[model samples]
Target: MPETTGDWAPADFERHGHELLATLRQHFELIRDVPVARPYDAAELMGRLDTALPEQGEEFPRILTDTWENVVPDLVHWNHPAFHAYFSTCASFPGMLAETMTAALNVNSMLWKTSPSASALEQVVLRWIAELAGYPGDSDGLLVGGASLATLYALGAARDAALDYDVREEGMSGPHAKVARIYTSDQAHSSVDKAAITLGIGLRNVVKVPSDDRYGMRPDLLESAIARDVAAGYVPVAVVATVGTTSVAAADPLEPISEICRRLGVWLHVDAAYGGLFAFASRMGGEAEDVSVGDSLVVNPQKTLFVPLDSTALYCRRRGALANTYRLVPEYLTSVHTGGTFDFMDLSPQLGRGFRALKLWWVLRSFGRSGLRSRLDHAMELADRLRELAVGDPDWQCPAPSRYPLVCLRYAPRGGVGSGTDLDDLNARIVKELNDSGEAFVSHSVIRDGYVIRVSLANIHTTADDIERLWAALNHAAEKCR
Candidate 1:
């Protein structure tokens, strides 16, 4: 007879767990020998794994074997050393361990009463992140799935704070409420638009301010947009300044923008999802562009903190504002007496929250500030070297500025391409060839109506040699395309 579910003996559980871990270790050991991504037939892959469900128990070891042979080989390995694609993420060893523990000790951190350690530790993690980013020590923050959700929460808070009436009870049609307008640069993340839509602020109200030469949001343009919105009888609620723009990592002039917000009485939310790491290492403009200058900001650990995918910290200068924006207490769930402790459920929209703080705690403890700084510095240094190579090469040039470890370059040879040849087509072909070869992977962004290959180096395993390899491959592909 087949073994009953959840009835495995300790010996069986321990043995299978160890074996599975060994298999994973072996896979990483031979990772360098395998392609970054191997193309597979969709129908064949579906046919292999999409079989009919079985009523009987399946052998765990066999399932793992099948996964190793079939599923593992086909995935686009985002953690690979040569993955210079969209903002690389890593499941560092410490984070992996923490994740395992978190799963085993699955507890809701929505309330301190639910899990005291999880909720309390989350606050400590927030403080640690603020300290790392050189942000205001008094700022209160929380960990969410990612920056997208954090942005939504931030704008929601801004919307509520802007309205004189209680938006939580009366909704968007609150008494004496004017249409809310949010301002962000053309280069800012799409999350702003999404947040606007989700919060009843239509896309039309979210003005896309013009960007300057460096792809940063122009402060003067932002001021003008706010002025125009106010004159048109729309309440200028918030301005989102991107610290690391999606296209080129362009940092908006925060000091001037902050000045505008202060003078105009608008909430300023800094989206530092990609560039917040600079605060831990080398920030620009001294105190001028500090993230703390904004009323609120978000920093993503998944981007540069060597953590796993999807963890963002949203911080607010107004300690009670976030709670005021989202707190809803049900009678049965209400505390008998206020214990002077925070109930995380009062913080944001989530009620069933996971123990995400453990991962950051483990990673912070493992790598420490200096170790993380060293890794981030290395990535930036590699980016600088890559830029040097592009500048030194006669056939290539960086179309956009390289502020962070992300750079935008194009294969534009001076007096080399034949007349009537399209530069975009040529550069796209180069990227296609590189991806098809599976040696490396990169993405492209359109800047100045030209296709620019974007190489982002935020992965922990990425090294100078990996950058050199990608550079050589790029040159070879450019030659082939020509």
Candidate 2:
């Protein structure tokens, strides 16, 4: 049969989709092949396509072609092998396919009755992730957007468990007004503070536990802080131990942190957003580190497992605590509930959740455990190589050991580039030069009051050649420094 000319027909859509996919792939190829380009010129883009909204509509093929020409080129390709900036993952094709299918189905997995498969899949996938993270066999967990929400949920559980008030039902009313305090390493992600603020816990109550030389939170400091808080009539509710710190991938002493929490009778939550997956690939028994030391664990498969974004697993040792914190079943919503069913509504804050688990399920089955392990192993190996390269050169300094697939190094000009204002300006210029050149993309962070450049090797496609290109770009950027 001839192709239908109008509306959205299956065959017609598929044909156009294939063409669009090719165009998308072509844009990615350009990013991989020519990693560097001048900034997008506004006037140049204005000449390529329409500026105003269409009154009626245009052909799908024309839209695709125009998008390829005008839109795709402007995007910074996070999937590019050389995109070593920030915490990122180049998601596998299987993950992309799963996302497409789930969006097409558009299942809302609020409860078992709402979408049985999605609810069940999320439960099964969360359990699988928890096992990989080394959570105890008795633990239960749920899928959340990412670490931010995971922390919020864990903190919510802390509030509920410690105060003996069902805040979800009680509506933060009569009881549960105790001054709650949470602790995390000074180097921990800023999400903890944000979560506390949203929870109505004062930001001042989020104590920054000092770190040891390795940058991990100091157990001694933590204990002293807890002791002081308890003495001052404040409830030491929760302590967040970071598995992989955002700045340098530093790991807190989990065993010690857990012990401190236990003695203080406080809840322990491990924020391993960046580094928890290494627990599985690390000599510690792949994914097992996530479960070993906390009442709750937050792991982002999206960051390290090549899964797409918005895939995070929150594993909790105390299932009752999670349900008690978030469960809310109105009479109308409970009508579909039959006893002994797994309803996700009891564990998550969302009433209408997407089928996010399908993507991870597909990726896990497609790659298998061994395949995923190999990818992680390769990333760490490449990171070690980069670390060695940086440290060997007198022009650069690897200030800290990169325990995982992330390294932070700073370029130093020989004979002293400048002093005072000039020194800071030189480092600033170096960072801009490297990013603008795009031979490699490196992120910047402030450590001990000095700016440093960071490179993360989390992509499966990253190669030794890519590492070499990063070094070359660093040298070039250093030369550009005043």
Candidate 1 ranges beyond 4 A from true positions: 5-7, 173-177, 282-288, 336-339, 418-420
What's the lDDT for all of these models? 0.85, 0.80
What local lDDT does model 1 show for residue 97? 74
Which has the greatest TM-score? 1
lDDT of 2 at 422: 60
lDDT over C-alpha atoms for residue 9 of model 2: 78
TM-score to native of every candidate shown: 0.95, 0.92
Q: How many backbone collisions does model 2 have?
A: 7
lDDT of 2 at 118: 85
- List, residue by residue over 1-482, the lDDT tens digit for candidate 2: 33345567788778977986786676556656755433666777676654778666677887777775667666566777888877866787788889888988999888788898787788778777766667775577778888999999899888778765555666544565678789999998989999888887779999999998888899999999989988998887799998888888888888878887888789999998888777668444343343477898899999998888889988888768888877878987884556657677788687788899999999999988888878888888888888899888887788767578888887775677655646556767887788777676777777773777878888777788888878887888888775
lDDT of 1 by residue, 21-74 (tens): 898787778766768886678999898889888888877888888888888878
Q: Could you report the Cα RMSD, in angstroms, for every candidate shown?
A: 1.9, 3.0
Q: Where does the lowest 10-residue lDDT sum fall in candidate 1?
A: 280-289
10 residues in a row with least lDDT, candidate 2: 282-291
Candidate 1 steric clashes: 0
